[model samples]
Target chain A: MNYFSSDFKLGILGGGQLGKMLLAETRKFDIQTYVLDPSDEAPCKIACNHFVQGSLMDFETVYNFGKQVDVLTFEIELVNLEALEKLENEGKKVYPSPKTLKLIQNKGIQKEFYIQNNIPTAPFEKFESLENLKSKIQNLKLPFIWKCTEFGYDGTGVKVVRAISDLENLPNVECIAEEMIAFKNELAVIVVRNVSGEVKTYPVVEMEFHPEANQVEYVICPARIDDKIAQKAQEIALQVSKKFNHVGLLAVEMFQTQNDEILVNEVAPRPHNSGHHTIEASYTSQFENHLRATLNLPLGNCDSKVAGIMVNLVGEENFSGPVVYENIEKIMAINGVTPHIYGKKETRPFRKMGHVTIVNEDMKIARKIAEEVKNSIRVISTK
Target chain B: MNYFSSDFKLGILGGGQLGKMLLAETRKFDIQTYVLDPSDEAPCKIACNHFVQGSLMDFETVYNFGKQVDVLTFEIELVNLEALEKLENEGKKVYPSPKTLKLIQNKGIQKEFYIQNNIPTAPFEKFESLENLKSKIQNLKLPFIWKCTEFGYDGTGVKVVRAISDLENLPNVECIAEEMIAFKNELAVIVVRNVSGEVKTYPVVEMEFHPEANQVEYVICPARIDDKIAQKAQEIALQVSKKFNHVGLLAVEMFQTQNDEILVNEVAPRPHNSGHHTIEASYTSQFENHLRATLNLPLGNCDSKVAGIMVNLVGEENFSGPVVYENIEKIMAINGVTPHIYGKKETRPFRKMGHVTIVNEDMKIARKIAEEVKNSIRVISTK
Candidate 1:
């Protein structure tokens, strides 16, 4: 396609940190990029060749932005599917096609697809509304996981329904009741596929959750799990990508149950955070592979050069104003630690400000340093 | 200095490929940068927060640009020393200070500096003008190297004086007459120092020149030499950096004499081409270290993760117009091969278009792939 230093323009939706990181790969290859985001101060606003400040959810905005570029892709899934469908109809290339997104966007549909395809996943019941669920509460499982069918991200739009009172505060929205499977570890495998059907899987990564927040605090690549489990997770991720016929990065999140049975939980069809550590540790970072896949370029080697652990820097509690990374220098002093700040000037409690990647040949040392980095650096706001 | 996602603006004087690569680090850390270059289409124009189009050699332009940032550094050395000196006097921080630049800006002065510091170097005599050299040709050694005192870069302003006729076409400018020593290898070592005096040296790299053009064609990291030779080169590079009290990256180019003695050739006090492979091979890239050094942050790990080889992508002979990289896809399919296009839209003969870095665990395999990459990709132009 003559993408390098040529007239080929690659359009990216959602100019957040993922888009910012994607721009790094585009800049490395000298591929022209146009970014669309609602924020004027988006992290990607500086690196892209052109930036259109507009909503990615608005059909007209997304359509107009797509019209100016040769190829279209999105970092976030909230983009307007109708617009992308129309663009594809008109002969524009949209990776992870609208059809793939349609099947994966709704939790009810996603779980059904997994069961129909004979993929291993927790059984779930689809509910048209919270009222509908209440009417049939007597027959359903008492302690199932409730998740909204659409618009969920980063632990949002999800809840554990342990009892009747737990349903009182739930929104009356289309949702799914997923069987709560007792799991020992949450893992993710990123599968990359090019238009030519070339596919590759990155090493499995373990997601460690914050005990109270129930959110991922660290992502460790080459998860310290049995080799057999890792291989199973990779195979499952590949099956999901093949079933969807997706062309791009499909990050499949899975759970290892008490009996070591790997069950598919969900998927993010883009450069997922679980693969962020690859930037410093792997032969080919997930973001670069995503770009190469979207462009139909030959995929790169996905081997790890060293073990890597990523610690996300979320905003501190009770602090909301101009962002400041306290003790950033302290962590920089540690060997093999590289911090990537998102360039957001403001800070709100629990908001993602940046992430720090710790890499080392010794996994144990890398893990220890990751803990040190997490403890030493605080993302706070200055009034 | 609150450089991370703060108001601290790093002013870079030249917005060429070096500055573009440096901007990648600043963008990764969310550090604000202001770049100045004469061309509006410079590779760094879009990446930097602010870009000023002005001649870096003009004192007023450089002084005005320096006033806008917290600290000033130049990717290119041919900047106005008067402006930097003035800025330093007014309390602005300039790394690789004007004093150090003044000593190295002129080949005559740089050679003399080495001699006065008791450093090993080829003996040389400075001349007021080329005419002065002609008057003393009878007494001087034949087959010596002749170089202009000021503004020489990338094998330009240099010539071999084997006969009196070799001086006929030379410019009437201040020059140097250096006794040419028989050397088996041309090596380089990059030494990084922070403002607080912490220093580190990158692995030595071996440079192979184009036989006809006298320009470096390939740079192999961890030079294929005995451990003792590598240590000697690093020690000599450190001694040179200490003598200059240099801050930021000091790329010392050296010669390995036939008898295994190391001698200083020249140096560049910024991110250099020889260290370009570090971006893909080392734990800390030279660009990142340059940024850390200038910010007075602790140095990063200087160890290499894999062996790296870099091949310069120069414009194809007799081609001059819009640029195109032929068979780039063919080379990209190779494992561990990364091509960095410099975003230069036009192509002129012998002009540097970009560079490709090939990395592998085995140095022999990496070098073989580098050769394949060099032979496969052609930087040509469409008229």
Candidate 2:
């Protein structure tokens, strides 16, 4: 297709930062793009040729938007899958497919898909309701994890089942109780594949968790682990992409067990935070590669040009108004420090306001600068 | 100044490719910008916060636009100087002030300024009209070059005079008659300075000319000339910037004679086409540094990380209508090939449709890929 500077319009669902960066590539290639998102202040709002502000989860909103473009893709999941499925039936192109999102959107179904594919994962039981789990508490083991099958993300929709009293406070909803397996470390492998069967995987990355929040606090690339283990993670992630017939990027979150085995955790179908380092480290940034794959263009080199460490900027506590990047200029003076502030305008505590990438020839130095970047700039509300 | 995600509105006079690249950095930093361009289909139309369409040379249009912006700057040099001077008098910040532009805008005036400032350049004589030049041709030698004083760019309004009859057919207008120096090569030095007096110069680049057109065919970074000669070029360019008290980027085009002498040709007080290689080759892209210097922010590293070669994508001689980058994918397959298509949907012969930048660790390899890029891609008319 004559996509570059042609009449072919590439439609992107979700006018957030991911879509914003994708639009940069499209702009570079002089490709026409139409972006749909609910927020008028979305980062993609300013860069796209056509900006449609509407609900991404609304059936009519998504269906109408999908029908107008030649090829349809999305930056964020959690859109109306039924609309995409209908669009697919009507001959519209939807990348990653609504079928793929359906299987991955629900945690219980995702785990079952792993089991069916012979993918190693922790054992889990899907309950019809949280009340059913309470009635069978005597028979069920204590100190398990309860995760809502759908609408679960970050640290939400998941709770620790410690005792009988803990079950009383739990919301009565369809969920999964999984046997919390002991893992050495949380890891991730980003696998990229084009429809032409050309596939490549980034090296395994280790995610250090926050002590209190149990969420990823830091992601270190080329994870410090046995080479064999890292290789196993990459191999498994590639197999998953092949099995799912996934096109574009698939970021497979994994676990490294005490036995030195790799286990599947979950997979994100679009560009994930785990691969943010690629912007500064890789010869082709994940943003650029994603565009390449979606456009069916030749993929660029994914090898690291320099060691890059990414520090995400979340809003500070007790701050809840207009966003400000304090000390942004200070870090711009430091070598290898590049800050990207998502033009959100508003900021609430724990909200992702921006990210700073530190790249250097020395990995050690890059990490040190990343830590300094994380400390110096506070994403706070200026009221 | 709370420029990031704030009410700071930056006004840019021209929304051409340079302004588009500059907007990329402004968007990265979340600095709001208002761009005015004659074309509604300008590359920066979607990138900036607000874009006004009006003739940049219109005094009222420029003056009105400047009043709405907190600080004003420009991409193209042919803006209304009176409006800029008026804005400066009214206490608005204007980088590369009207005074600096006055000295650099017209070729005849620029050459005179160099002489007055004790800068070394080939001696030239200014003429009120071309008819007057014919009358004075007896005293002047043959084989000299004639150039229009203003509005000349990219090989237009300039011609070689081998005989007095060459002037007979030429347009009777204000022009410059320069002594054709026996120069072996054309060179350029990009110097970036701020109001704070922090100055930095990118290494001199060699401009390879087309034998027929007498136009720059390729810009080779780290000019093939000796290190001493390159250093001399940079030093002389810095001296020129210092003399102008220039803020932002000043690209000094020069000529190197067979005796290894460097002569100032002219200067451009903006992010120039010559420095486009810095986007992929330099430690900090020229666009980024221009923003820093204009804001009086600390200067960035101007050193090149890789050798870069630039090939201009001019319109094919036989095609003039809709633009088509034929065989663009073929160049994409080559390593270090990055094609930048200026968002002009139309094409015309010898018109600068766009330019491709090839960067690599080795200058020889970059030059080779540049040749491949030049051969493989044709900016033709598809209509």
Candidate 3:
């Protein structure tokens, strides 16, 4: 299909930062895009050719939006599966098909699928309800990880249980009790696949979590590790993607145990934060590759020109309202520092306002600059 | 001032492809932007926060738009100088100040300024009209390059006159007759300077023009020339920017004569086509650097990560109307090939509709792929 400057329309389900970045690639190719997002002030509102404000979880809204475009994809995974299934039956293309999403949406089912596929993962047990887990509390590991079966995002819907009393305050929901593995590091590899089944995997990236927030603070490319370990992580990620039969980008989060065993933790079937540094450092950005994958175009070169580190510009504690990026100019002075503000008009505590990417031919210099950037810039509120 | 996610407004004149590319940087920084263009269907219309449809050459329109912005810059050089001067006098920050533009808007004045500043340039004489040129034909060199003093853009308003009869059909307007120098190569260097006086120069790029159209067909970075010649070109470009006291990007085009001496051909005081390859090859793209310079932010690294060659995508002859990029997919299959389609709906013969960038660690490989891309893709109208 002649998508460039043609009548072909691509429908995107989310209009947040990922969608905004994806639109940049679409704009670059002059591909027509229609975005359906719930917010009136979505960052993607301006770049897309068409904007429809509607909840992605609503069946009718998603189905209507899908019907208008030749191909449909989502930046976020919390979309209406029924609508996607219906669209597929009606002959529309929905990447990361409903079946793939169904198998991965719930934590319980995802764990089950990983085991069935013989993928290495932490041991876990699925509970229909929190009550069932409470009734058998002593039989389970004391310091296990408890995660809700569905609707878990970011660091939410998750908790670490230490004692029986900890379970008392937890919400009653379908959940999983996972044995906590003492991993040495968290790593991720983004695998991209086109409709033709041609696949490519980005180099493994290490995620450094904030001590208090339990959220990713830095995504360092070419994760500082042995080459053998990196290769293992990539192979596992490829294995996961092939098993899922996923389309577009699939970012596999893995845990490197003390013995260097790589175990699957979770996966996000879209552009992941771990791959954001690709925009400045790689031959082809993950966002651009995602678009190419969805369009069934040949995958681009996925090699990095330099080592890159990403620093998330989350809102500071106790700051809310109109956003301000303090000391942005200071970081801009540093070589190879590129800040990407998501065009979010407002900010609250812990809200992701933007990110800064630092790249250098020397990884040490890039990391030092990343630290300087982290120390200089602050996401604050004007009011 | 907090530019990112703040209320600081950046006003840009002429929403053509340059403005569209600039908007990509603005969006990256989350800097609020207002764009003015005569056409409602301009490429910048959708990407900017607020887009005003108005002639960039109208004093009232430009002034009104300037009033609403804290800082004003332009992608096109043909904007009303009177309005910019008025805005600057009223304390509005305008990069590449009106005074600098005044010296550039007319070829006669630009040539005089270069000569007065001791800048190397081809010798030239000003003419009040074609009749005046005809009257003094005997005194002028036999084969001189005649160019209209004002409003000459791209390859238009330029002619090679070898005889008195060549002036018969020329327009009756102020013009300049320049001594034609025998040049072996056409080169360009982009110099960027921030308001704080921090200046940097991109590597020299060589332009290969179409034999007939006299328009640039490919822009090859690193110039494929001796390091000494490249250094000389960069030094001259920097000198030109400093002499003009220019802020933002100043692209200096030059002619390398048979003796290897560099002479100034002309200059564009904004992002130029010659530097478009920097978007994929350099550590910092010209558009991003232009924004940083305009905003008084510290400059980024000017080094290139890989060699890049850009092929301009012009509309095919005998085809005009709604445009289609035929075989774009076929080209995408080639490694390191990226197509950037300017969202222009209509096409005319030799009109620039887009460009393709081919990048590779090896320059020879990049050039080879560029030729393959040029042969595979066709920019033609479907209707």
Candidate 4:
């Protein structure tokens, strides 16, 4: 299709940071885009061709938004699936079809699909509710990972149960108890597939956690791991993409067990945080690749020109109001440092405000600078 | 100054493709921008925070717009200078001060400034009008270059006087006759200076011309020349920047004569086409550095991560209607090929619709693919 500077319109659901980055690509290509977001202050409001302030989960809202565009896709997955399904049934193009989303939306179903397809994963048992799992506590292990089956995002619905009392205040919702494996590292591979079945995989990235906070502090590309392990991670991610038959980007999060075996952890069927560094490091950024995949254009090369590292700029604790990126100028002075601030007016503790990417020919130098960036900048509020 | 996600406003004049690209950096940093352009369908209308439709040369329009912004800059040089001077007089920040622009806004003044500064340049004589030059044609060289002193852009006011007949239909305006020099190559260097006097220079770029059209075909970064010659070009460019005392980016176009001596050709005090490849090849893009310099922030690393080549996407001679990028997909299939389409709906002969940037580790490979891209895509119309 004549998408470049043509009359074609692309509809995007969820006008958050991901959508904001995608809009940069769309603007680069001169492709018209319409964004549907609930927040009036969404980061994407200024860049998109047309922005419709509405609920992404409301059936009518999503349906009407989808009807006005030639092709429909989404940045967030919590959209009204029925609206997309209905739109697809009526001959509208919906990438990563609603059917694929169905299998990946619910944690229990996603894990079960992996097991059914002979995909290696941590063993898990599904419970109808948290209470049901508690009733069988005597038969379960001392400590396990408890996850809600649906509507969990960004560490919200997952918990580690070290004692029975840990489950007392938990919501009585559908849940799963998975046997936790002692993993040495958490890795991610972003797999992109076009509608024509052309596929490519980005290099594996390792997520390094803070010793005290237990939160991811850095995402290092090329994973400082053995070549064999990186290959294994990429191979499993490609397998997941094929099995789901998904169109667009599929970011597969995995674990490297103590014995070096790879296990599937989860997958996000869109541009994920793991690939944010691609904006400055890779030949084609993940956001651009996702747009190409959804539009069925030829995919771009997913190779990196230099080693890259990304650090998230979350709001610091004890401050919550209008946002201020302190010491941003200092980081800007550093070599290969680029900050991307999401235009959110307010910031709460641990809330994602932005991210910084550091890239260099030398991986060691890039890592060292990333640490300096982490120490130099703080996201706080004006109070 | 709390520029990131704050109330700091940056006002930009001329909302064209350059402004559009600058908006990408502003969006990345969450800096508020206000753009003023004459066209309602300007490329930057969608990306800027506030877009005002008004003549850039209108005194009242520019003055009013400048009053609302904390810092003001321009992408195009044809702005109302008196308004900017007024703003600067009132303690407002106007980058590339109006004084520097006065020396550049006219061709004769720029050439005289070069000579006065002891900068090497071609011999030239300024005329009050074309009729006056014709009266003294007997004393001038037979085949000299004639250029209008003011209001000329993009090859519009420049011509070669191979014979007396070639000046028959020339415009009756102040002009300059320059002794043509035998040059081995055309080169450019971008120098960035902040308000606080910090300065940095990008690597010299070589502009290769088409053998037949005599128009630049490719802009190759890290010009494949002797290290000494590149250094000479960079030093000359820095000298020009220091002389101008200009804030923001100054793109100095130069010539490497047959004797290997560099001569100043011209300079642009904003983001220029020669540096577009920096967006993908450099550690920090020219757009980002221009924004940083204007904001008085520290400059970014002016180093390249990979070799880059840029090819302008101009309209075919025979097409003039709604534009269509024919075979754009074919070029996109090539590795490291990225086409940036300016959002100009209509296609006229020789109109700059967009540009394609090819980047790779190997310069030879990048040049080869740039040729493939130039041959594959045709900027035609859907008449």
- Candidates 2 and 3 compared: the better one by TM-score is 3
True contacts kept of each: 0.84, 0.42, 0.88, 0.91
Highest DockQ: which candidate? 4
Q: lDDT score, residue B205, model 3?
A: 96
**Candidate lDDT values, in order:** 0.93, 0.84, 0.92, 0.93
Task: State the displacement of the C-alpha of residue B225, model 1, in Å, after optimal TM-score superposition.
Answer: 1.0
Q: What is the lDDT of residue A148 in candidate 4?
A: 94
Cα lDDT tens digits for candidate 1, A91-129? 999998998989988888899999999999998889999
Clashing pairs in 3: none
- Considering the true interface contacts (CA pairs under 8 Å between chains A and B), give the fraction that model 3 also has: 0.88
How far does residue A345 in candidate 1 sit from its true spot (Å)? 0.9
Model 3 over residues A1-383: C-alpha lDDT tens digits? 87877789999999999999999999998899999999999999988999999998999999999999999999988999999999999989999788888988888999999999999999999999999999888799789999998988777788888887878877899999999889999999999999889999999999998866667899999899999999999999999999999999999999999999999999989998898999998999999999999999999989898899999999999998998888888888888999999999899888888899999999999999899999999888889
Task: Give a tens-digit lDDT track for model 1, residues B158-212.
Answer: 9988999999999999999999989999999999999999999999999998765
lDDT for residue A221 in candidate 2, whole number 0-100: 74
Model 1 lDDT, full chain set: 0.93
Predicted candidate 4 versus true structure: per-residue lDDT over A219-323, tens digit per residue: 999799999999989999999999999999999999999999999999999999899999999999999999999999999999999999999888898999999
**lDDT of candidate 2 over A247-346, digit per residue (tens):** 7889999989999888898898998888887765665677777877777777776666566777877878889998888888888888777777778888
Q: Give the range of the ten consecutive residues with the poorest summed lDDT in model 3 chain B.
A: B207-216
User: How displaced is residue A157 in candidate 3, in Å?
Assistant: 1.4
In candidate 3, how many Å is residue B59 off? Answer: 1.5
